[model samples]
Target: MRRVLFAARSAVALHRLLDVVPVFAGDARIARCFTLVPGSDFGVDALAVVDALGGRVVPWEEACAGAYDLVVSASPKGELALLSGPHVLLPHGAGFSKTIRAEGSADSASGLDPVYLRRAPIALHAMAHPDQVARLRAAGTGAASRARVVGDPTLDRLLASRPLRDRYRAALGTGSRRLLVLTSTWGPESLLHRRPDLPAELAAELPYDEYQLALVVHPNEHSRLGAYDLAERLAPAFDAGLVLAAPREEWAAVLVAADALVTDHGSTALYFAGSAADDRPVVGVGSGGPELIPGSPMDELLRSVPVLGRGQEIRRALDAYRPGAARHAAEAAFAFPGRALERLRAELYGLLGLTPAAATSPRLLPSPAPARRMPAAFDVHAGLIPDGVRVARHPVGLAPAGHHLAVEYGAAGEQVTLSAGVLYRRPLPSGAGWTSGGWTRHALDSYPGCRTAGVVQPCGDGVLRFRGRELPYAVRIEARVEADGRVSAVDPAVAVSAAHVWVAGHRDWDGGRVVFNCLVGEREFRVRLREATEGEAGAAV
Candidate 1:
């Protein structure tokens, strides 16, 4: 059996190598040894990535000392030359569009940078397009002689997964909501770094039930910040219902699920644009376009893709979107296209000194739903409607700017602070539930600034619980005409906010029915509450 070493330097590099490893699956002739090469900041979660995939790992030092037929790596960084074998370098991104700068070195074309290539001498250099090979030759990088156009396996996998877009969206649980994805390469030029608060800002501007926002940050940032710190840093965005795709495995599926994209010069954006047929609009944020190689695919993309434009809200841009020249431009950077896996397999087999095995179709397995967090608290904004009011809500933790605050009672770390007024869930007094006004007075005494509180009963599950300060007894309420609807089973937090708004307008509001018009994006949900008797309260606690 021919020994092949899978040398991974970073999370991004490991992801790229993973695409190649699948090509050799079921080939008994090749024995694989995986090792994570240190000496780079892009190390966090790198080992976990391998463990998650169930790879057979060899210690880094032992693997370096051992003889191998082939040493396959996705990145040119790290001290790879110490390993004894014929080294092959794989491009981890969209054909190395970014100009890279090694530590204590000048800027140069990414893959063609002789300094890094010299440090990690490679026998084979896989290029995604002819333009890339030509660019390498122009850079005076002597290794250009070894570089060959083998197409992009990443893009190829994405093309193979295109038909599963509906499944991808369904997996993300994006119900009646347009999925919006924001991508960024690591560094100051990234979308997140440039506009640090963009995620929370977008989460606030876009209506909660209408838009689902996801982030696809590069693994370099993922490694440097560490997953825990990064997640904590983006805690606000998470609280505002941000879906975070893990650095490696989930981003492709997230891209497939997206209805729109907001990006910087990340390579994934270019890949997505190529596959999505310009059907989904992309709004480019920041001026990181020039950071890529001149006339490279990503550079051209930024030049043509719609700019977010200073002072223009992304929500407004998405509401009025137009297709850009992304597909035509991005397609030019890929050669062999759908046949990358086939062509790349032949190339690797030749390096490993083995006859190419019969080609078997490879497919990307359906990705799991990405990790997401729903807002536990919201600043509920309301305006007047016919009998009730029109309302909208924003996350209190991320971007608080509403008339009243609504917080999920008994939520983790539940801390009730004095705001204009707060809404929560509570158990109504046993015999005096919304009738004797005992629960309202009891709730007011317990939670400061709590103007509205609600409870759902087992029998009358989809009903409202409300009361007035001056009224002798509280009035039980049933959702008006919404017997079997989303709002009928309304969230206590949201429902209490509606009650809070209703009371402000109707302080002298005696018992009666009041309708609420809630705006979810451009659509309106009418939630009306008709008075119910104490008997119909159904022992709601």
Candidate 2:
């Protein structure tokens, strides 16, 4: 016993009809059915029919209070606020409607919901009309979740029975060849109805009685016409073969049977276009709004009726109906139905405790593939630099094997200057605070022979001077070293190369013994030394 409440602000007849049909269908369990009518003329007769059929009828405000499993409604804002349970929003027809005013403004102000922008989680607009589904998907609210083309249940009723067609034709006393064109009377607030020249324009293109026209007035249109009864009074001008249907269901059935249709922008076009896919034709007249081309059966009908003078060219183009092209057109037009329904179901189920069936295997929604991570910076083969060597100045030169190294020189506490032709030897610098005896300097001096003689210096230009001879500064040493023990250098601003270089090392240079490789002659040699102070350093000397 699942309780479902069908709510609407108006349109009592449609809601009443929907409530009764499900009982005969048998698959759907209906614990309770309700309709909420706002104003006077609550259509007591319709309420009587509902009561006679074993359903309860109540005013709009009172009906909203009761608990229900699912509450479905046509008004998006009102119903969303009133219903305290799983809700289904059956948007009335496809084209832009009042809900646009409500949701459109909110969307404009707050920006789209991120869930809708990215995943579009199969909610929001699930059970909407077909075209509405397309519009929602186009707005980037993922189509995979929002709409399905299950065929509207309201129009489904018309498709379920064929006898209704004969009944409608018999009631009108029209021949089978007679084209039934139902025109809904536009209200004063309707943009099409208020224009004074539109009636005259409509009359010029449409000559009544030449083709059967059934003019239907929406219930609101009756009070809105004021002194001018556009359908009845102007019938003669447009060739008055006009037949009126007081009952709305009969009018819908007539639309189903009709060869073609003509109306301003309204839900009728959406309904006809959606449900009458197998029918003859349906044409809609719009004042230059979004026009549905003649592809689907309903689009054929909509394309047939010219909108007075405005869409005459479009009508001419649609004159020859192509049955062969309808297959592709039908697919393109009807693809949204299943997606819409799935979206609706997901949204509704999300409101309840029911979890959606997990996607067919985990592969359908696979976890994000793992990202590759880079290896750490300092690996085993990498050497660490000694703390004190400051490479201050150097000349550019090619080494013995065409490699290049910046010859660096330094004393205990002074900045190290590197040049191209210099070799640093012992007896580092005579500093009073650190070294003990003059013999200590002599021992340091003797360590490297005459290799310490020619210290290289730059002469302001791009040249190095060694023993008073200028050598071209053909190589450039980059400021940083690579992790692979290579230093980058450019020669003559053209060729770029990386070469092996080493930092200086010394003992007692910071209380720790330091050693570094230096290119000595053709082979590499490791130099080690210690710094001593006058007090404790003198004893070691």
Candidate 3:
């Protein structure tokens, strides 16, 4: 039997370690003890959590000096770093869309230290899935070699709570009123911080009779921002009938009870998207841009949902919300599904190099699962179609195909060109669910154009380009078809060096609009495209 130290530093780490401790309860091969970091703000709360779980908490020095065989921690930093024996790294959560899964860097807010893992002797690095391991390896994180797909215990809790949705809703007294819970993680760029008045604005606008609003902020908000500050900030929204949920409440309960979710870039969104508790609409506020890791289930959800770059879009999205492919994509990300606890227990015992005692329990350890294929390459789904471009009548490609546009750069300048034809995808069949659409090619001239708006500078008849010294250039084009049947002139698409980009348009009969919003780069540059009222075609060339 090995003596294990569960090191707690942050609130998130404590919550995660607690999930594992119970599964190994009364086991003979491992003896577990909890220890808190000296100055963690959540130490008192963590102690309460441990006491409730009937776990032992030893003093930090005593635990460290006890010569423990293994140290298991949510983070590799702090005491885990100081421990002499091999340690198992248990990161706080899954859903890597917001965090960088690469080797050297860690999610700044996640309390993990990949550098610590790189520095320490890691006996095992247990992740939610093999794809996660692959990403860490590609990022050059040294611990990838010791990584295993053990699944997440919290996910199991959420999955098991699925059938109790009604009970949780009743507890909230939410009767027939559609419940929408808004969650904002801690960060300056977090939605609540960015739009402090958002709840009041949403409450005042959304009909009180039909929908009830609730706010669940990250636990750090309570500690970092004092009660007076929180009360003062949230008072107006509370007065407007917004139910403020306690930060310590089980997130699974909230997810089970709520009909819809609104959040920014955080793990809460990932948890909701990845669970089967509900397939209701989840609207993400702010930043209608790419995720840190593109094409995961959560990433797919963000792309599919109407990510409101502006607050006004929130109401519009909710009015027309529906659960689509993102829900299924998210649900599929869980490798062990409802069996996380059992699977994780197996991984823990494997890490300790021991077999479980048969007399202890029949389900003590789960049989090893077959390796799952790594999730890769996000599908080209609906809702990402650009504004104001119509699919050509005789578009050549499959319903949902992808094409790469070429962008060539040189000391002279940069040139951008779209593929020669309109690569289009047809509407998915009714029962097809959320399968990836196949894209096919046709002539670029086949699609019709619409009236163009927004800032622009004219180039030739229908072309625009940007050339900035050492900066990646970006251009947005909106065009309206003129009476002469010519595609309204703003930008002609062509390919150049260094990078490849593409433009694909589909006919959206429902909205009577054309869409084109696909450009790959960190920064966007809008050309000063307005031509002088009367001049020799002078522009910001």
Q: What TM-score goes with each of the models?
A: 0.82, 0.45, 0.60
- By the TM-score metric, which is better: model 2 or model 3? 3
- lDDT at position 399, candidate 1: 52
Query: Per-residue lDDT of 17-40 in model 3, one digit per residue for the tens?
Result: 866776676777778888886655
Q: By descending lDDT, how would the candidates be arranged?
A: 1, 3, 2
2 versus 3: better lDDT goes to: 3
lDDT of 2 by residue, 361-445 (tens): 1001111112211111100111224422212111121011122222223331121122222332222335324222333233235
In order, candidate lDDTs are 0.70, 0.37, 0.52
Q: Please give the lDDT score for candidate 2.
A: 0.37
Best-to-worst TM-score order: 1, 3, 2
As a TM-score, model 1 comes out at: 0.82
Q: At residue 385, what lDDT does model 3 achieve?
A: 26
- Candidate 1, which segments miss by more than 4 Å at Cα? 102-107, 118-123, 142-145, 163-173, 309-312, 319-321, 353-358, 362-371, 386-389, 397-400, 412-451, 455-461, 469-517, 526-528, 531-536, 539-541
Q: Give me the candidate number with maximum lDDT.
A: 1
Model 3 alpha-carbon drift over 4 Å, by segment: 28-30, 38-44, 51-54, 99-114, 226-229, 288-298, 309-313, 328-333, 357-541
Give per-residue lDDT, candidate 1, residue 435.
28
